[model samples]
Target: MTNTMWVRGVEWLAAAAADPRACKREWDHGEGVALLEAGRFWDVLSVPERLGLLTLDLLWRPGLPVPGPTLVDTAAGRVGFLLPPDPSGGWVGSGLRCASRGSWVAVPPPYRPARYLEWLVPPDGSGTLHGPGALEDALQQANGTLAVLAPLCGR
Candidate 1:
């Protein structure tokens, strides 16, 4: 994309927070990440890096649409998927975490590089997000696959 397009995409992503200006201000100060409240714009599905890597591959595989923006929190050893908020809140698993209403997540500018947290898949600025059902299906498939293969080296 042209530089202008990516810049707009970054703005689009930061707007997910209640205070997009504050997020932008944080970035202006050279911070690599900003805290954003979940549920309003999207929910966060956080899982172990191992599961995240496998799940992402499945989501991007041949017939499936690519998953939405995903974050890898290296310091936290977790990967977070940005998903459309689900009012039902049915997600539950051994090592999975779903952050919806009343929760917050640290996110990076989708267009920038960061240390602890980086985007595995950045938002396209169209407001598309990972489908909850699709993500769950991918996670389940990944869980089964991990039993035999060693975890891939994560980003």
Candidate 2:
């Protein structure tokens, strides 16, 4: 049952990526709700400040393979996706597991008061941690992330 949900979520991401309309809808649908719930800690931020956080969550579904390695535009800079090591002894690539840990630690670290953005992306594909031009970099990162994950969906 859990596997089915993961696969479905992955499929939804693929569909959203291919269609702009789908992307907009999904961004406000399942993915949006998931992100909002996980990002409870950032509720204090203004709408614009929270855009980056919402965008990052939209592009990456935490533990799901569908939205793997997303690039997020942050006040710092463009950063790739990264997931904290699951205490259970492996990567938490399941939506359930990832969502369960909303305020988990992130590598390269985030600025104060924005710890919720830690799981944005991994360091390998990330740009400067919080340098400059993060949003632009995130667009490119998002394309690359989707391209890589789309193929895997067929399997």
* Backbone clashes, each candidate: 0, 11
User: Per-residue CA lDDT of candidate 2, range 78-108, in tens?
Assistant: 3333332233422222121222224421222
- Residue pairs of candidate 1 with colliding backbone atoms: none
| Number of clashes found in candidate 2 | 11
Off by over 4 Å in 2: 1-26, 29-67, 88-100, 104-155
Q: Where is model 1 more than 4 Å wrong at Cα?
A: 150-155
Worst 10 residues of 1 by lDDT: 146-155
Q: Each candidate's TM vs. the true structure?
A: 0.89, 0.21
| Local distance difference test, each candidate | 0.84, 0.33
Q: How high is the lDDT of residue 137 in model 1?
A: 90
**Residues 1-155 of candidate 1: C-alpha lDDT, one tens digit per residue:** 57776787788888877778888877667676888888888898999998998999899987777678898988988989989988777788989899998988887787776678888888778788998888889999998888656556342
Candidate 2 lowest-lDDT run of ten? 38-47
Best by TM-score: 1
